[model samples]
Target: MRIAVAQMCSGISPIDNARVLQNYIGDAAAQKAEILFTPEMTGLVDRDRARAMAHIYPESEDPVLAAACAAAKHAQIWVALGSLAIQPIESGSEKSVNRSFLINPVGDIVARYDKIHLFDVDLDSGESWRESSAYQGGTQAVTARFGETVLGLSVCYDLRFPALYAGLTNAGAEILAIPAAFTVPTGKAHWEILLRARAIEAGVFVVAAAQCGAHEDGRKTYGHSLIVDPWGQVLLDMDTEIGVAVCDINLQEVAKTRRRIPAIANRRTFALPKDFG
Candidate 1:
């Protein structure tokens, strides 16, 4: 199946982001892509916690999600609306859920996965992110079927956790989707290597659409979107550009790579080593 990953610089307006996403969806459909994947925070990208929270809405009222679903149905293509900043349904809630949705061709939302790992760190470059302060983390690992492949859903910071990927692969995921809005520092240092490692370890394809360039909030992000095969070969690398990267993937490669390496089948459990006094 042909898949397209879209990279964009999102601002504070969900409406504007939705319009940009619609164009990408159209482009993907024109290329006969069965699925279109987008980066995290596709609805809006803002560093100011208060301002972003004030602007966000629950899934039911989000114009971005509504627009994306309409575009998906119109294009007759499936969509992975990477991740959205969603307000809580309950009144008086202090934080929101960073959520990802899988929309079918007819616009029905088939699956949803909230971000499990919140990025809460104080960087050495005087930059810091307290994502948990504004968002609630997810508890479950989710996998869904997309045409000829089974997809594991994760977002941004979740990519750093390999055990999550292992669980997804064990749950029958042949492809892993890691949509991100990565900071420039970490993206440059660890993005490609971590993605390749996950692909090699799980024997699954890794498709990571990303957010890039400078945002209106005065924050910069790394924008190299990538698609890696099960053999740890990078099929597409969209280096720091706002565009669509498309690749035709064969599901049989997942089987072929696994059969050769047998990494998943070569598991052995052991106890932790005793510490020397």
Candidate 2:
């Protein structure tokens, strides 16, 4: 199937972001792409944490989500909305969930995955983020099947956890979607390396759409969206811009690679070492 990875520099307006995404989706459909994916914060990217909290709403009331569903129906292509800030059920507390949605061509939500790993890091460049302070982590892993291909869903910081990818592959995932708004520092250092590693380890195609350039909040993102084949080869890449890339993927590669390596079948459980007095 032909897939398109969309890279964007999202600002702090869901309406404007949706408009940009609509244009990109149209472009992808024009190129005959069967599936299209966008980066994290597809709805909006707000540097002001308080503003983000105030603007977040339940998924049912999110206009961006509704518009994306409509867009999917119009394009007749599966769309993986990277991630959106959604207000979770809370009693007198302000907490939201970083949620990702997979929409079918008919405008049906096929799967939803909340971000399990919240970015909580102190960068050496004086950029410190504590995502968990405002958002709650998800507890479940999700996968969806599109015809003959199985897709694994994950958000930004989840990429750091290899076991999640392993679990997805074990659950029969042939393609993995990693939608991210990776910081410039971390992305420059580890983005491609980690993506290639995951593809090689899982023996699955890795489609990573990323946020690029600087946002309205003075925060910069690393924007090298990529599609890596089972052989750890980058099939398509969008470097530092609002752009789209199309590539053809074959599911047969997953079987071929698994048969050649057979590593997943060889996995054995081991106990941790004890060092008690």
lDDT digits (tens) for residues 1-277 of candidate 1: 8999999999998889989999999999999999999999999999888788777898899999999999999999999989999876764676899999999999989999999999888978797778888888989999998776799999989999998998999889998999999889889999999999999997899999999999999989999999999999999999987978799999899999999999888866779999999
RMSD of 2: 1.5
Which tens-of-lDDT digit does each residue in 109-227 have in candidate 2? 99999999898889787868798898888989999987678999999899999999989988988999999998887898999999999999968999999999989988899999999
The 10-residue segment with the lowest total lDDT in model 2: 87-96
How good is model 1 by TM-score? 0.96
What's the CA error at residue 219 for candidate 2, in Å?
0.8
> What are the Cα lDDT values of the candidates?
0.92, 0.89
Query: Clashing residue pairs in candidate 2, if any?
Result: none
- What 10-residue stretch in candidate 1 is worst by lDDT? 86-95
Candidate 1: C-alpha lDDT: 0.92
| Alpha-carbon runs more than 4 Å astray in model 1 | 90-92, 273-277
